[model samples]
Target: MQGDTKLKVGILTFHRTTNYGAVLQTYALQKTILDLGYDVKVIDYNNEEIYSYCDYRVLYGKLPLKTRVGKIIRYSHNKKIAKTFNKFRNKWIDLSVECNTNAQLQSVEDGYDAIICGSDQVWNPLAIHFDFDAFLLSGVKGKRISYAASAGNITLWEKYLKKYWICLHRFDSISVRESEMIQPVENLSEKKVRLVLDPTLLLNKKEWEKLEEPLGNEIEKDNYILVYYLGKNRALTDTVKKLQKQTGLPVVLLGRQIEGIKSISVPAGPSQFLSLFHHAKFVITSSFHGTVFSILYHKPFLVFGNGNYNSRMNTLLSALKLQSRMIDNESANLERINKVVDWGQVDSLHKALKEKSINFLIEALR
Candidate 1:
């Protein structure tokens, strides 16, 4: 099946968030479907509950005095980051008319041939502030499918098995991001759940490099270590410091300001995030997408397991036969840092998975 202007597809995922992975995955999924020659647009479904977390002002009245003060100080910094994210959304992601309520979302379902809700933790209630109806496509009359849809940890889904069973039955096809989710999702829905790569991995290195922007005059000329961690782990911090001292290279921190780490803070959006990982001498992170980008760029990197949320990262690395790249304990062996990754073997495995994932999408759309 070639590109069909009449075959309208709408993507439902966490596209409005300030996080790099959320926005970039949305872009990758939308771009991939659009490239297949179908009319595609992200179902710009904005939940106020989800929006409040992104906008600091929403919690101003509810927080304690001291916490509120801290929020005030970070407000401007977060605003700048949010602005960059908004710019990227407008420029790259083709979005449908804004839909805030479930009724609003249901109202637009008839417009799409198939609604794809996926490539992110959309099924995770906490991630979406318990907005199940929208993400589950409750009242959708058209075909429904999920591509790499993750629920973070599979244990979270056990409590909501009944809900999963009902909602999942509405899906024409189902696929999950983490391998652990396959059994649970399949058991709940009684549908054969396919384990697929994250949307970021769906696009190869050259495809992603096209979206990468330069780091500008800010440490672009310097060979630096790129550090991107979502959590505040002392072990990761210590490892970064040790690596910096051992390698004699400057460190560039990607997200918020971390205490005790003397690193350059670059207010980077999705594109700059790509460039950082692309040009880094080595990458150190605790984020799943951070690890994905590191692998995509073929960068030498180490990913710290993020407590219970380590399953996703574990699945990916294990699949690629790069288990040594993940550090699960506080004491990391820096010897693995010098260990080279066999890209030829890794790429061969990755290509097979990528082709299988793309085939799933193609067949589902047909």
Candidate 2:
């Protein structure tokens, strides 16, 4: 508590996840709250599912290619990614003692003056299964505020409507990441919901630059297109090939070793991830944070959407007036990929959105 000994906040987020976006957003949110003079700790909720997302051993069993050699290669790369992300989590994130079960979370809930869950797909049912109830903080004796929490896809199924309605009403303040999510949440919960920016946007480029400076010019010396695809989108690979053919620039796939595509063998930490975005000649991604860092670095980028994951990307692109940058299976041609973006206008809109998101946090915290 920097100011008047305010609330000790515990942020329950995707901080433990191996995804670059998840870790970065968790850091941003924690930093923002700390800057506001509140004590904060990223609650380290232990769940095997969180670690399994990037684990090659788990994915290896699912992969169609069952050769021992192929399994070993995938396993090693996945371990590298997991190790790198774990290192980042340890260095940048201040975490509480691990809590794996509902009983553990319940026992520790009262330790916080307030609990914040946010800035990621924590509410996305597809990714989180067991801890959904824990995130609700049912037994916690503190203010429950959700900041920029996403519902993943906008189409909320009726099956979970009652559960969400109950959880949404329990929060002291609720803010969703997407505009479309606000309406559905408001409708289901029968409560006012604020639309907020992703937590990563809270910190400026200069703040992120400090982290990148240490990583040096490893990625900067050469011109390359950065491809960060999180989903199994077959068309995205074809699109990347098309981009390579059109531009003649080498494509660097981060944390993913796609067939026939050049990729960084080791998983990159947060700083290294930012450096890749900073030095990229162009960026193409399916992940929301990939588009975010591209915009932060002022790099020319294209966003592609797949399956239920399209809503968040669509909402973000539409808001920033960069809808033209979103391409799909049919429209992902050379000309469409080459479409220019007006960064000046996008920056202006981003500034306003950032302010709104901050205001919501301030009001909720107060």
lDDT of 2 by residue, 1-366 (tens): 345877789998878776789899998998898888888899888877755654454454555655656667766776677787788778888999898877888677779888998878778776677356876666677889999988676554456777777877888889988777877888877888998889998889998987762433444434888888876677778888778877787777774577877654435778788888888888878888998898898887878777777777787788888887887765376676556777789889999998999888888878
User: Could you tally the backbone clashes for each prediction?
Assistant: 1, 0
* Over 4 Å off, model 1: 1-5, 54-69
Model 2, clash count?
Answer: 0
Best by lDDT: 1
Residue 106 miss distance in model 1 (angstroms): 1.0
Give the per-residue Cα lDDT of candidate 2 at 277.
88
Error of 2 at 363 (Å): 0.4
Give the alpha-carbon lDDT of every model: 0.87, 0.79
lDDT of 1 at 193: 90
**What range of 10 consecutive residues in model 2 has the weakest lDDT sum?**
213-222
**Candidate 1, run of 10 with poorest lDDT:** 51-60
How much does candidate 2 score in TM-score? 0.90
